[model samples]
Structure formats: structure tokens, C-alpha cells
Target: MSTLNSSFGSRFGLEYLPTSFMVRMGKREMMVCRDFRKRFYAVNPIMECDTGVQAGHLEVLLFRRWLLILSKSKAH
Candidate 1:
């Protein structure tokens, strides 16, 4: 995807798993997850329109050196 269409910290090549989980190297606090999710939805509009997907549910967790993103459904 083009840089303009990419999410924040895209230069790091965020790691997303098959289990609706994502890991990245950053210092993101829980309070920022909502804002982050908003930006994400903005870039990937399909997530918002797809009825079969539960894109609004996003959880951010901090585990030592990794920042984890957990969602109800897998995202490309």
C-alpha cells in the first residue's frame, strides 16, 4: 500500500497473525487504541462496511517490549 494509505508506524512492517492478533514494536498506551482504531478504519474502509466482520472491537495490550492488537475478526 502507498505510504499515505498506510497506518502509523508502517515503516516498521507491523506483524499481524492469523488469530486476529497483531504485534508491533512501539510504545502505545491503552488510551490511544480507540484513536488508532479510528485511523485504521479510515484507511481500510472495508472493515467498517463488511457486515460479516466485527471490526469495531479492538484491544491493545502492552507486554514488555511488544505492543499487541487483538480484534474480534482477522484483518488483512
Candidate 2:
């Protein structure tokens, strides 16, 4: 895997237009989730969306979790 795939990499999401360049994140020292969302949807550049979870896989995982909870509640 390359640097872009790692947490140390400079990956970001292009979900929407960035209203501001950077926004405060942390409570103490201060942090931000900057909108270089444009940085990802480049014509020729680095790859990978900022999201870590796969949506399809997440859906299945969530279903399984909900089923587990239901089963536990109805256990006899």
C-alpha cells in the first residue's frame, strides 16, 4: 500500500463543496477537517475517498447487528 492509503497519507472526501478551507475540530489544541474534497476528484492525481468504511459492507454489517439485537430480545 502507498502513503495515500495509509492514515499518514493525505486522503480526503469529495462529497460536497468546501464552504471553508478549514474548520476547527479538536476541543483543546485545535484541529480541522479541511475541504480539499476537490483534491480527490482530480483529473489525474491521488486516489481513494476519505471514508474508511465500505457502504455496502456497512449495510450488511448493520443488518447483522440489528438481527442480533432482535434475536437477543426474543430469546426463549
Candidate 3:
């Protein structure tokens, strides 16, 4: 396996390591990977607007909300 330093060095055509751009990542720094299984229609490069996916997301959010409300009411 190619090390991070070697890959980056080779890309720049440099034989040795680069002193700059070398920074450590924090332990708590999370890499949040979004679920891309569902393909949503994109109106623009920044915006996605798929009716089916939107509906499903809404349905799931609503169902969870209702369940929480019901559980709280039952506990009272």
C-alpha cells in the first residue's frame, strides 16, 4: 500500500516529503459519509429535488416523530 506522504509526494513530482500541507487530523474530527444509495433528481449542482426520495425521507421523519410523541404520552 502507498503511504499518504509518498502518494502526495509522487503527485507533485517531488522525491522527498513536503513540509507544507502536512497537518494532523483530530481524534474527534468525524468523517460524516452521507448515504448516496438513493439517487435524487438535481435541479442544480447544489440542489436535489426528487419527489420519491423526498417523500420517503418525509415519511420516515414523520413516523419517528409520531412514535416519540406516542411514547411520551403513554409514559405520562
TM-score per candidate, chains pooled: 0.21, 0.15, 0.18
Q: Tell me how candidate 3 scores on lDDT.
A: 0.23
**Clash count of each predicted structure:** 0, 1, 0
lDDT tens readout by residue for model 2, 1-76: 6321212113223224343122222321111223232233333232222323222111111211110000011111
Runs with alpha carbons beyond 4 Å of true place in candidate 1: 1-57, 74-76
Ranking the candidates on lDDT from highest down gives: 1, 3, 2
Name every residue pair that clashes in candidate 1.
Answer: none
Candidate 3 residue-wise lDDT, 1-76, digit = tens: 8443211213222234232232224321111122223334322333332222211211111211110000001111
User: Of 2 and 3, which scores higher on lDDT?
Assistant: 3
Where is model 3 more than 4 Å wrong at Cα? 1-33, 38-43, 53-76
Worst 10 contiguous positions by lDDT, candidate 3: 67-76
| lDDT (Cα, tens digit) per residue for candidate 1, span 4-58 | 2213333223333222333333433111222223233333322222221123434
Which segments of model 2 are wrong by more than 4 Å?
1-6, 12-31, 39-50, 53-76
lDDT of 1 at 6: 19
Q: What is the lDDT of residue 5 in candidate 1?
A: 25
Better model by lDDT, 1 or 3? Answer: 1
